[model samples]
Target: MTVTLKNGVLDPQGKAIEGALGSLGFSGVGHVRQGKVFDLELEGSDKVKTEADLKAMCEKLLANTVIENYTIALD
Candidate 1:
């Protein structure tokens, strides 16, 4: 699962990193956004059920839905 701040939401950490990159002589870098990635191993083989459960987890705890968005990618 990946969670990221929504567009138009202020991202101070991203901004700070962008500034630091500029200070380090990395030019033309802009609009940096930060996010989270979760790697999980589940016992179930049901893809549909697993996706549902993952979405529930994001909605309930992993992500702040109001200011963030999440995506689930399975491998």
Candidate 2:
């Protein structure tokens, strides 16, 4: 699974940090995106099960349908 930021949402915290960095002499910065962290353990240690479980978790609990997006990867 993969994660991404929800489109058209105003990320004020990320934006403020990005704007501040520019004024402090940082250059060539384009987009500063931010998202949430999702952590969980499942019954199986296989990649397919983990991915499936993560997708279900994302749909059920880890992400907010109104504002954020998320993805899953096995460690």
Candidate 3:
């Protein structure tokens, strides 16, 4: 699963990275957004059930639904 701040959300860390990049001579960096990626290995074979369970986990703990969005992928 990948989690990232929604549009218009304040991202201090992202801003800081942008500034650092500019200082390092990287120009034209309009905006920098940072997010988290979670890689999980599941032992289930039911794709539907696994997706539902992953969504539940994100809603309950993995992500702050109020300010962040998450996308899940099964490999």
TM-scores, one per candidate: 0.89, 0.75, 0.85
Error of 2 at 29 (Å): 1.1
Q: List runs of model 3 lying over 4 Å from the truth.
A: none
Candidate 3 residue 22 C-alpha distance from true site, Å: 1.9
Model 2 regions lying over 4 Å from their true place:
1-4, 41-43
lDDT scores in order: 0.95, 0.74, 0.94
Q: What are the per-residue Cα lDDT tens digits for candidate 3 across 1-75?
A: 999998899999999999999999999999988999988888879999999999999999999999999999898
State each model's C-alpha RMSD to the native. 1.1, 2.4, 1.4
lDDT of 2: 0.74
Model 2 quality (TM-score): 0.75
Candidate 3 is scored at a TM of: 0.85
Return the top candidate by TM-score: 1
* Ranked candidates (TM-score, high to low): 1, 3, 2
lDDT of 2 at 59: 85
Question: lDDT (0-100) at residue 24 of candidate 2?
Answer: 95
Least accurate 10 contiguous residues by lDDT in model 1: 30-39
What lDDT score is found at residue 65 in candidate 3? 90
Better of 1 and 2 by lDDT: 1
